[model samples]
Target: MATSSSRIGARLLFGIVLLFPLTYANDNAQFPYALTFGSSTLTASWFTKSEGIKAIQFPVDSKYRAYFEDALASFGKRIMRRGEWHVMAGDELVPAPPDTHNEDTAVSLFRDAAQQVSRNLSATLGFEPTYAALTLSSVFNQSSTKAATDAIFPNGMGFIHSIKSLNKVAPAACVAHRLDLCGNLGRTPAECADKDSISNLILVLEYEKEYLYVDLVFVYSEYRTFPSVGHEMLREFGEANREKLLKSMSTYDYNRKLHQTLNAFIESLVERQLIVRVDIRAIVVAGGASATAIAQLRKLAHNAVGNGVVKVVDEIDPGLATAHGAAANNGENDEEIERAAEDENIDDDPQSGDPKETCNNDAIEYIFDEQQPQTFDGDKMKEMYYDKDAWVSGFNSLMMECTKLYIFADKYSIPQLRDDITSALVGHSHGWGWWPDPDIDIIELVYNNLPSSSGLIRLLVLFTAYSWSSSPNVIAWKDRFRGFHPEYLLDVLFAQAQLLENEIHGEGGIPYDGMLNSCVVHEHLELGEEECRERLAKHSYIFASLLSACQAANA
Candidate 1:
């Protein structure tokens, strides 16, 4: 077997070899290009370390435009242009012609358009780009279009991934350095001055043949827009009236969509427990339509976000921002590859067990031996609770696992483990909501395994009371109450009475708020609040204090 020192030397040499080519290419003659595939137009921007940035727009062909429209209209179902055909006599099926339209035709069209644009760009610049990053219009940046996009763009070139890395680029020089032009009012500088203190909304409004594609992204400190926040939306206007009534109709449609989009984005953030409304501090507009609708967009944004600074990124052509961002993201990809290579060199010991399996085995051994466990991985438990597929497939099994762990912890006087299990159970319920019949099984398990004085028993009683009281089928719950343990039924009756009293006094309704509070569920008899907080920080558990005994044993 190789010694540890030899492994280290090998890793260093491997890392050097892996990164040398990329470093030399970046230094010498690397050309990175970004292609933003909009609904009506394709914008391509190329960046050179020496010559700077250049962008051009390509007209989309009518057939591809119709395909995009039809794809969106049918909610991403493949639009068949040619009916199915079968060979009547041949032993083997005949291959379809290249031009034949099928599920993959749309992806091919995208690739062909990109190739044509690349040729034109090469002609304009007198050299071909070495790398390309691709982004789709807001309308196509969705789960529905994921398959088509995956086929066209590589793993890391998706709009979300590119924009996420682009946020790391210095915001002040992001546009100015590439285009060799600064913002007119110095607004970009002022907004980017202390990026950590404020959240920025990057809004791109691109005009397509029949619709305006609006894409919104939030960036602040380490926070970003959630993947499911409906980042992209479309506003339709008649294409036939392009010249006569386009401006007026476009303004009205954009204004309405902007309002709706902002509301929905903000509401989603709040609902996901991500951020508050007041956190949004700036709106940065980019895209082809931005210049024309600057005044209206500014007004709408300020009104919606409450004193948020609105700035137009006009230093570079607004439509080129996505392309430029993509080009900037090339460096990030290089770093990711380097890190991945370095990771492969370490952790090569064949004797080491998987961390997750080790953790589980250690816990089981400790429980049986009546000895303190070496560590409690709260993150693993949290993962188990949040896994939607596992919840759907076997929720009762999951709950029973936690219940059994909690019962064992309580019996062995492992307060920290018991508290962690309680927090996990409560968080699971809060995340997925209550399941009626399975929850009853959980109650029986708890009652049979633990005493009435247990905090978990109390929490279940409150949850049961709240659920049954608010449910339309209270009568069914009442009938089911007969089957529950007498102590559990009594505690639930008291909790129901308390809920009624609170409603009567106009002070109740959300028992979960109290149940979710860390202090209410966690035991603090042995550890003080400050010590508990430190333990929690150490273990990274969101809702429970970490086990001091476990930490001591590990140390």
Candidate 2:
């Protein structure tokens, strides 16, 4: 009775029913199994009814029913092991761990899958997979920091380490997550938080939702949890800069004239009645070149636009924040990352050592197409936070970032990702590291660790590297992407240029060119200011136009 669309799922259930070992416990699975938004697959080991929950959660074998029958639920997708990226529909077929019905094999397999939960292998089930140990704390802060960490970690980040620890998914570490101990107390440190207090004041308009930090707003238009699948408004997050706009909208004085200005501004724009008929995707704010361009944009945007979030990063080392956070997390290893730093001379300032050489705009011009770095003086200096120690720390922090990436990558089964982890373990840079010459041995390590199928993907990237990236398919894909973005074009051009330049014998674009000379960023901008700007604008125009075409087509 299954329709074509549900046929695959139907077969999956049939397989599970047949393969499910009858002797073991048939306990149902639970919710939020892994970080993957939604998942429901639990079965207890076979045992006497008195010993455990008896019966298959659902009568008919259906993915959702099985999950729902067990009181198991998740956000959107299932989490295999690492739970990083989902196995997209087009991915090559691979083996599923439990293979419950050999159903998952037709679809792509997750990277880090566990064949069985709990140590019992003969285990009785519930929620017993993963993790080593969980140490609850008297105070959230005490458990949050590096000071209290055990080498092994808990499954819910800090709740249970091994799958054998318990059955059924437990509530996340809640409440007093001590940020000092580096813990979110007992709660999870999700990416977004909002200023709820201000919402009441802004209710002057209907359809107006409150946003505090706004970065999280990208996930859900408001704080409400929208279903992950269909009928969604936007992606989980907005463009990165969206965070900046949110703060400025909330910037008025509650005391006097400024408060009046803020309130007036909100009323004029967000009141719902003003631009109710206009369906502009978002308000666009443009500012003439000025000393306070950002401020001007904010004021104008709040008055005219409904105030989508606007965020600006320091730009110099945006990577710094991510690295710092990863380092602070106990799951990440700092020493290996630090050691990788010691091997490089990336911080030499390009000026101090060489008598007359300056790493100024002129000096950095070698990579880009005749583009020189923008002459940086007082004004430019103010925009950047360039500290050597911080840079070093950031560089050192990459290993842990690699570790976190590993958790995601391994879970997701990305070929390139697997290679990166392998390379990092042996002290080579993977994707996270600036990639002139990624660490060869390290890449090998990641290759060694992958599941057979995932490892094959890693090997492809490796082979392409030694083969000068002339792989026909890669070239075709790059050429196709180049038609859309100027930046991507620049990268494609450079990679191809380097592939030929190295000739496996010469120097330029050689495999060992270190991070500085090799970073993909080097090729995007030319050294000559005029040429760089011209090309940048030209490419950006192409990208924009392509986007417009796509939008029009969809419309």
Candidate 3:
């Protein structure tokens, strides 16, 4: 027994040595904790729950179990014993795939579906298969001909999911990096075999030479259970019968909510000439679905856009397809996704209520005579206009236009245009003689439209913070605060903290206007700078307290 234990320990140590490199590699890689669906981004913690066998049934008194438990403890892993199950069993548990208040799941499904379609199309057309998930816009806005759309190149290498094989993306061989289980917790090599337990729906696409499989999963509310096992059945409804079903919503004997969601989306696309036709072979319903529910969905899908035969299968792990597929393809950049959306035109803009164009300002507009007139030739170009109001207006307009252009470029995969616009914004901010200060209105406009990832957004925030620090009266601080997103506010505060910490002095030791204005904002409802001082002090204290609590629990 002693020799056997020594052998086990030796093997465990060997496994650890083999695992280090994988751990180091994945330590820097980012996982998809949040998914974007239309305008909303939903958090998905379940997608990344430490990859290991949870709730493994082991003998309560087995000496091997003790050894494994000790190993897990060394790695800071908790083991749920049989007795603990009794305690936890009584506790009300939230269902799997927690966040689903918005249309995130639906959008995720559509995005993956569209990408699969694009891949098939690429193969058919003899183009390189793209790995990126298409944006909602790209699916709807796809050009009528390959010749027209094919001219534009793919933005960058995007994340791709091996629908048929999760291991292709996750590489089950790297289980050591996935979880620190102290060399698989003393389990034998046979015991640690890949379970392939995750639920997923397989989508098979037939190409000329071979078949491609696209696995999918839907994130549905576990709380919303089907009323009966096989009570309701829904058939496909097309454009011809859509109005009748929508108008008589009360008479519908199906999952009306799900039906309407799909109905509205398909209707919107078809109305805009985006989705002319769908050749969907299968629409598998999985994850907390019953026979009746699956049938009902099939009917709903049929009625919504039922042009041809669409089969609906009831399968397990439908959600796995989305979660695993997304995790596999998490490395895709924003531009590739945007281009996909632009081409598809599935995701509509709320403000514009139209398809976002892939082409940039220059591409859309023709220079009839580029050399004819050199406007503001030589002498006039050098005249530095210091009109604060004019500068503010012109720069504000430029930012707004750039904001649009930048978003356009990002969305349509026009990297060149995006880079040009970013350069222009940065150059204009630094080089131009007059400091262009955008007032509350312009600030709000950019904040609302531009994504946090945008370079322009960062520049605007820094400039605004500095402007507020330099001269509080340059912009209406109070009004601006009312419209600023919480994220924007937090970013500004973080910037302010960094600026103050660096102690970069202005003309004097006096506090800069940006930091001062930030302090003033915090100091409101308090005497002098009391609130501001408390905020700075409390930030660190609060974080420390939380960390201590986490540590205590771990211990």
Candidate 4:
């Protein structure tokens, strides 16, 4: 029995030696721990219930489990008793494709569904179901994609589920496609020193672009050409109906409140001759309600002589607009727009009903030719809202306040609180999320404020996931600015493994966010299970783990 024990210990030590070089890169390595003796059998004290595993949780997914088992198998790992499993494969005990790396989240889900089966890999059909007692129990106290993390991306990566996959644009990404058109300026001549000049207007907004575009929207100088800043939208009382045009500008707080000012938009469209004004049924409408606003304006051009009509011509390449405008202005410099923005009154401007009481002047600032001469007429030049009648898919048309979701918890019972936090995590893979706030708002609400076990669970789970997601985002964003680059992840993981190990040695570990959760790795490994933490910090593993989390989120 003593010899047998020595043999097992020798292999484990050998495995750890073999593991470090390939797994941990660019960091000072820690020597292996001394194995306990006097007992003939391996015990559960090491991996499970160790504080280290709770910090920087490891072996993020099935791929991780696979690597560990493969490594242990070479040393003839196995479970000779209950409450344990082992890594036995050298003697044909376990076999998996050697080169197979679990780079995809699909591996985890392959075991998630009932009646799901595949000899190799698949989700729902091949993986164990989430509700399975064994699976849930295995996940109970572990820090893994399944155990601790929550999806942080709004609409989950814009739309993609996998981390390697490209993220879709946010709904607000349309802000990038924003454009403002001006008319009734044919005789106004591009403003030289005037803020309303077309050249200056173009210069302010066209700060930089690859191509220049000049859309000369022509209209008779005789009519009042509305400066198309905000879309002057019309409201509908019923199908094919147009209400009075709203004179007031939309509020940034609720700029999408089309329902409030729909009537004004439709009427103004007709008034602009962009659409036909007719009875809802009588007007030959095409393209559904989306075209209703435009149809009203088209009707205004009928027999009226010298009526205002909008014509769009290529003014310049969109790429060169800013550079050319800037270079063209001999007297104006970069500070010119800032000066104009600083002096211009935001509150009293009749044309701009934008309710943002004060403009930061620099924060998203731009300039363009002031549409219509700088006459302080009580009347607005002209503004148009976005296509509210179009499919306002998601929350486009509603500038709604954020929703607040609060789950109650007492200040005690930290362990059970963790379980509840786990339950919340399971459901987190899907959901629209709360509104009272921004994405990180809830963290502020709960963190440090909760004293109960349950609250700690919630706090830890959310804070960890939030922190984890940030690493990748920050890493990805480093190239955008100076001194912001994230070093390659290889070094990062090596450091993480060191941290988890030290924390485990300590009685309790504060999670990545500083809450204590029972460490399960050492205990589980003692029960013939392989460790998962080191693998989590691996480039391939973290990358793949994020992919799995993303996939689960999209799914």
Q: 197-303 in candidate 2: lDDT tens per residue?
A: 11111111100011101101011112111111111111111222234444555423212333354345444544644322122122211111122333443354344
List candidate 3 stretches off by more than 4 Å: 1-384, 413-416, 439-442, 472-483, 504-555
TM-score of 4: 0.15
Across 125-236, the per-residue lDDT of candidate 1 in tens digits comes to 5556544345665454233243345444544233322333232112312332232122222336765565444444444444434554443434322211111122443444
Cα deviation in Å at residue 285, candidate 4? 62
- What does candidate 3 score on TM? 0.24
lDDT of 3 by residue, 38-128 (tens): 1111112112223411100011123322322332222211212211211122464322232122234333343443344344323333333
The lowest-lDDT stretch of 10 consecutive residues in candidate 1 is 1-10
Q: After superposition, how far is residue 279 of candidate 1 from its true place, in Å?
A: 1.8
Q: What is residue 525's positional error in candidate 4, in angstroms?
A: 25
Off by over 4 Å in 2: 1-468, 474-484, 504-506, 509-555
Native-to-model Cα distance after best TM-score fit, residue 227 in candidate 3, in Å: 46
Ranking by lDDT: 1, 3, 2, 4
lDDT of 2 at 365: 17
The best candidate by TM-score is 1
- Across 416-520, the per-residue lDDT of candidate 4 in tens digits comes to 223323222222211111111112333333333443233332333433333453356545644542332122133234435544655567422333332122222
